[model samples]
Target: MTSFFLIDDDVAARCMLATIIEDSDLGRVVGEAEDGYEMEETVIRYAPDMLIIDYLMPKQDGIETIRRLSGLGYAGM
Candidate 1:
């Protein structure tokens, strides 16, 4: 089964996304975060198959997060 890591400032949105993913048999939620800052470690640890990140966040945005992850050699989809 595919695994997913979710990143969003809104808890409700994360919950909803998890529900949708699971209900649709798309994947399992392996981890989640409220922001994009300092998430490389957790992401690496989890090594999920996919990442669902929100575009706007309080600390860091999704684009920057993806770039940072890419630099860190995280090649998840």
Candidate 2:
């Protein structure tokens, strides 16, 4: 099964997405982060197959997050 890591600052958005993921059974939520600061650690811990991040977040943005993650060379499924 595909595993996903979600990062977003909004609690409501996170809840909604989590619900959808659970109901759809599309994938498992391996980890979640409120902002960029936590993303790095969470990503490293979870090593999810996919990362769905918000465009805007405190401390870091999606682009930067992706860039950083890419640099880490995490080849998720």
Candidate 3:
């Protein structure tokens, strides 16, 4: 099964996306984070198959998050 990690500042958005992804049988949510900064280490731990990050966030945006994740060896999408 496809595993997913979510990074979004909006709590409701996170929940909705997780539910939709799970319900659609597209993937499973393995982790979640409020923002890239808060989740850097945790996301690495989860090692999700895909990362759903918000374009805009408090601490870090999607691009920055991906950059950080890549630097930390998280090669997932």
lDDT at position 28, candidate 2 = 84
What is the C-alpha lDDT profile of model 3 across 1-69, one tens digit per residue? 999998899999999999999999998999888888857889888899999989999878999989888
lDDT of each: 0.96, 0.83, 0.90
Task: Give the distance in Å from residue 4's predicted Cα in candidate 2 to where it truly belongs.
Answer: 0.8
Steric overlap count per candidate? 0, 0, 0
Highest TM-score: give the candidate number. Answer: 1
How well does model 3 score by local distance difference test? 0.90
User: How much does candidate 2 score in TM-score?
Assistant: 0.89
Local error of candidate 3 at residue 66 (angstroms): 0.7
lDDT of 3 at 38: 56
Q: Model 1, which residues run further than 4 Å from truth?
A: none
TM-score of each: 0.96, 0.89, 0.94
In TM-score terms, candidate 1 sits at 0.96
Q: What is the C-alpha RMSD of each candidate to the true structure, in Å?
A: 0.6, 1.4, 0.9
